[model samples]
Target: MDTLTLQSTIRMNNGVEIPRFGLGTFQSKAGEETYNAVRWALEMGYRHIDTAALYGNEEDVGRAIADSGIPREEIFLVTKVWNDDQGYESTLRALEASLRHLKTDYVDLYLIHWPVKGLRHETWKAMVEIYKQGKARAVGVSNYTIRHLEELLSNTELVPAANQIEFSPFLYRKALLEYCVQHGIVVEAYSPLARAQKLEDPRLTAMAQKYGKTPAQIALRWALQHDLVVIPKSVRKERILENASIFDFELSAEDMAEMDTWNEDYWTISESYNPECSPRWE
Candidate 1:
């Protein structure tokens, strides 16, 4: 297997380099908590950070980045437009707000937080314009299924550079992963640790013992070995550091296939987020 490290990156369709592992800031509060987490991650050599406007932590994330003394170009930053902010003009304004909150001129990648029912196409058009204006190095969507991807591909000119989704050994959406791969879209795993849902499963625990690593490491290694980007979120310093320690070991192919059998199509996000069953357009 190829060696992996903190600096390992995968090139997107737009030719932008994105780290294979990143710090995810979901549900992280918008002040010192988030600021400290991001700061520590950066100080610990993390080069990529993912946040979304809906997380309400962009300001803190920006503060952490600014305080880290890391050069802006050295970090790959990402943020998304929220559902209500999913129209052409609105998305343009939303990006401006995100940029201001992030205290940056542009984001490495800007994504649609969800494929909001009717406005997705228009929102995507705005995203393309944002890309053309150099405000977003690359554009993408989150929680998008193959059906949603098809819609975007059939209507938009630029293919999404990434798709952020709930993924783990247990909730693995293999077909979606395959679709994204076939379309040259990088699949980023959120809830990559199953939000701790299966972290203590006997299978994971057994694997952990075999590898002499924590169950969390085993879970993360599973994602990394599949060549998918994994961002396991945590605000605690030790946990933050622990999340990045998956690069040192390799999971065997047999183990990989065994982990693959754990999938149960579980949905970790709130019920309202089901792409096929979103609430009525607002």
Candidate 2:
């Protein structure tokens, strides 16, 4: 197995380098909570931070980055355009709003938060424009299924550089991961630890003991071994430090295979909201 590190990165189809491990600021609140989280993550050597317009914490994220004094060029900042903001003109405007909130001239990565059926194609057009103009180092999609990706591919010449999804051993989505890999789209796992819902499962706990790591670490290591980018969310200082400690060990192939079997289509996000089953993507 290849060695990995806290600062390791994966190159996108467009040749932009994205850190393999990142901090996900999904439900992290605005103000002090979100601010401290990003600050702590950066202090601990994290170079990537994922947020979205819908997260309502972009200002705080940007504030933390600015205060870190780590040189903006060193951090891979990412934000998304929300559902209501899906359209050619609106999407373009959304990026501007995000840039303003993020207090940066441009984002390292900008993504379509969700595939809003009729509007997603036009949104991609805006994403292409954003890339061409250099406002985003790379453009990608989040919560996109194979059908959604195929439709965008059929219509546009620009392939997304990454695809963010609620992925973990419990919700493996093997076919989706394989398709992303085959097409050179990096798969980024958002809820890599399954939102702590399955952290106590005997199987996972046993594996954790075997590796002398926490269940969260085992889950994150599993994702890393599969070559997927992981952005496990946490606001606490200890958890932020703990999440980045997966670099010291690698899971054995047999254990990896066993974890793969643990997939039951479990999702930290509700199934109704899952891109595969969501009517919003139809």
Candidate 3:
């Protein structure tokens, strides 16, 4: 078994260390299913896990973390406040709820799940407060477009430690990537495999053939090459292990150029992010 090496870790703005590769528990079912997924992921040597309140699987994730017997400090647990929970008071309560559900006193990273209409600034304020109070080690956002990030910078004191977005070769975000690099925000690729659509992509396959690795691994390597934290998810044990096997080979610059050119108007998620929202999270 190839252990995920520490040579790949990325240091965030807040001095919080994050593993470049991790398991993403988005939309994983609740109860036993999520618990099993988290346990399996940890058993397979995943040290970071990303989840959100809207997914409703925090308790299951927490249970697995607890049972894994991995000390709380060893795991990089991340959760977010949902759209409805965007106000200062609501975000505070929401963080508490996520903590209780995850069975932890604090999470490594807490994020705003989305930038809904009208409430992102206030939510950011609340997040800063939480960070200031030492409730969360770092604060960040997900699905925040560049416009949203610019507005956040204009309004808030804390620069986000990360921005987990849907990034793959097919949806390459060159400008946003540069912006994040300039701003000190680590760009995290949530759908690095493009929801598994890129598994059979010819460009990726050709590179995989050349490198003798899977297309999934090629996709991850591409993201990592750009210094993005890539979270490729899987419930199957073989896949869980396979996703972490990108450390052995490096994608060549010519192949990286070809893979990078694969981007042509593709995005997996809908529901455009508007930073305005009604004050409540349910």
All models: lDDT?
A: 0.92, 0.94, 0.85
lDDT by residue (tens digit), candidate 1, 141-212:
998989889878998889999999899998888899999999999999999988887887999999999999
Quality of model 3 by C-alpha lDDT: 0.85
What is the alpha-carbon lDDT of model 1 when measured against the actual structure? Answer: 0.92
Superior by lDDT: candidate 1 or candidate 2: 2
C-alpha TM-score for every candidate: 0.97, 0.99, 0.93
How do the candidates rank by TM-score, highest first? 2, 1, 3
Model 2 Cα RMSD, 1 decimal: 0.7
Instruction: Kindly list the per-residue Cα lDDT of model 2 for residues 40-120, writing each as its tens digit.
Output: 999999999999999999999999999999999999999999999999999999999999999999999999999998899
Give per-residue lDDT, candidate 3, residue 264.
Answer: 72
Candidate 2's displacement at residue 235, Å, is 0.3
Error in Å for residue 225 of model 2: 0.5
Local lDDT at 41 for model 2: 99
Candidate 1 residues lying further than 4 Å off, grouped into runs, are 276-282
How far is 47's C-alpha from truth in model 2 (Å)?
0.3
